[model samples]
Target: MKKLLILLLLPLSLFASLNIAVTYPYIGALTKEIGGEHVDVEVLAKGNWDPHFVVPRPSLITKVRNADALIMNGAQLEIGWLPPLIRRAGNNKVTPNASSFLNLAQHIELINKPNSVDRSGGDIHPDGNPHFHLNPANVITLAEVIKDFLTKLDASNSEIYNTNLLSFKEKWEKKLLEWQTKMESKKGLKVIQFHDNLAYFNKAYGLNNLATIEPLPGIPPSSKHTIELIKLIKEQKPCCILHDVYHSTKTAEFIQEKTGIKIILMPHDISALDSIEDLTSLFDYLTGAMQ
Candidate 1:
């Protein structure tokens, strides 16, 4: 009986899953999809919270400390909160220099890179816009990157990871066509945004971003700037204000009262809104927002 019990537990230990810590909900979703039963994901930030201002809680440090591998959005999106968690966690596996760590931003080409950096310009990402995941096409690229990373860490399950990635890419590519058709009519349409977080989305769909509600990146809206924006909206006659769920829509609402423009709430990631549950649904909500 003792020999039989030992044999039963041997297979379980041979196929133990990896614990992956991801910086945001979307990355967690992607890792889980590719990892399937081979891995467990721990998300650090809430999708509904401001990605730039996540609180570095003690719980997050513990998650990082226990993770077998770590993945982050990078491009300085988590610059304010992530580093501290990694430092306090004291997990060599989660550090940037470790082989168990992955930075998704390095794989994707970032847009809106500032020519120069300065504090006077409000918050600016030196490597261009950190919100590259907004583009649906980029999502596919990220899926591939995650697949490769997972395979490297667990080659024994490489076949399963490859199959999952292929299924994801096939489904995603079909949805891409559907989204393109849905957004084709809105191409070249002018719009306003509370912040330029949707830069990649706008570029992907050919939507023109006239201006941002905030005077500068990471800066709050001001009365003077609000007045100026109202004037621009009236003059430009943009379709609507694409507002992010995390930011206060007060400034956009005021502009609406002044100009009669519409405000559409755009969620940034999984759980950003109740309806956004996964990667597919996240893009579905985004592409269907205009309708």
Candidate 2:
């Protein structure tokens, strides 16, 4: 094929370039940062579509099918949509065991793994909490993973990926320190969450998670749970009740009606809301809500 020959004859820098596809905007944004200008990234899902609730669109299918590599957060964060997309992408490069297939959750410690293995027990991730992105430290770990992945897939430019990763990690680490300081100075700031999804973020901010609005992570927030949340809010007197934007506003509205505490809606991912387009904006809006 003429195109294939062109690809081969191109310089290592040119040939090493790739079209990467990611499951969500957050991962895509990070990959773009680490991959730099060498890779063209296509984010499959929009931010508001709860990463767990994505319905693969034709565009996403096309992107995945044509991508040289597919990057994901793993840990079942994509259980709902990714599997179908992978099948649809029809890209052999993304198949497990392929050199270009990278699962970012690799080697990261997971929390809240289920003891049982039955879906009938309610929606559960046997792989544990997939909310690792909420913590900036995990991002640092994953950037290295991406850096390595890119280098392996395109070894000629290994130094570029490595350099970008180091710079990004250094920048992110400094920001993390400042955020930790902000959280520590505002100590004893407890809060109740709509679900356990915000655990890592709460931990990062040093906020005390007194309780959750849902008894179980995947279980829908119920009347009984809200009653419990109201009591907990009364007892802890948290300045805010943090809820992801994808959650039911009615439940939050009801809670606000009974308890006069402010309910803060934060994006759980880069694309969680329309205006919260990128990582910096997402962090800025979320950090602002905490303030």
Best by lDDT: 1
* Model 2 score (lDDT): 0.80
What lDDT does candidate 1 reach at residue 104? 98
Q: Count the clashes in each prediction.
A: 0, 1
Model 1: residues with Cα > 4 Å off, grouped in runs: 1-9
lDDT of 2 by residue, 104-221 (tens): 8776888778787677756646688888888777778877888888888877778899889889888888877777765666666888787777777777767788877766777788
The 0-to-1 C-alpha lDDT of every candidate, in the order given, reads 0.93, 0.80
What's the TM-score of every candidate structure? 0.96, 0.90
Q: What is the lDDT of residue 195 in candidate 1?
A: 84
